[model samples]
Target: MLFPIFLLASVAAAATGVIFKPGAWYDGLRKPGFTPPKWAFPVAWTIIYLLSAAAATRVAGLPGAGAALALWAAQIALNTLWTPVFFGARRMALGMAIITTLLVTVAAMTVSFWSLDRVAGAMLLPYLAWLCVASGLNWRIWRDNPAVPRPAA
Candidate 1:
């Protein structure tokens, strides 16, 4: 029950990536050398979504899970917002801001989840690691491409 709900939320968040794809604008960005290859995004995201959903499902019915669940929702909402802000609007700085906030939120979520279920907490480790990589990438793109113009309304 909870697993499906969490998976649905992840799928919805992933839909944004499909909608605001990285086409010419992203291709033109001066990304860091550490940027993962183009093929890695979806593959990594697939694993991430599964792991995060599992973690949330594990913690969902436990005692004192309300705040942890809220953190999970916050992180997911932040995750959903990043794609459109970065790819659709071409607002790297704002995207960077979102990702940074997401990173913090996930960190807090990870800790909260850990307190509820150690395995669930451990499940978020990969997500935290990925967020680190993502945050660095977002920061680098914003820093390296100083003159990127936002898309017109």
Candidate 2:
């Protein structure tokens, strides 16, 4: 049961990427120097989400797990929103800002999880690390592509 929940959460996380599949929508932007290959995102996120879910499941029965779970869910929602905002909506600047916020929220949530169960908290470390890398990448993308108009609406 726990495995399925984790799998589904990872899949749910992946579904967000579907919004960016139409290459026409993203062809105009300049990628950062360190921008990862297209194939990397899906693999990285799937693993991260699965690890996060595993960590979370271990603490499923804990007293304060609800708050930790809520924070986790909120961060995931924020994480999912980033792809659409950046790639689908083409709002790189706004996406960078949002990613920054998400990064902080994930950090806080990680600590919350850690307090509840160390293993669960540790499970989130990879995701937090990736978000830090991502935040830097997002800022670089915005900086490198200064001329592109911010998405309207």
Point to the candidate with the largest lDDT: 1
How many pairs of residues collide in each model? 0, 0
Off by over 4 Å in 2: 22-28, 150-153
Q: Once model 1 is optimally superposed onto the true structure by TM-score, how far is the C-alpha of residue 135 displaced, in angstroms?
A: 0.5
What overall lDDT, based on C-alpha atoms, would model 2 receive against the true structure?
0.79
Model 1, range 78-136, lDDT digits (tens) per residue? 99999999999989889999999999999999999999999999999999999999999
Model 2: pairs clashing at backbone N, Cα or C within 3 Å = none
TM-score, prediction 1 = 0.98
lDDT of 2 at 53: 77
In model 1, which regions exceed 4 Å deviation?
Answer: none
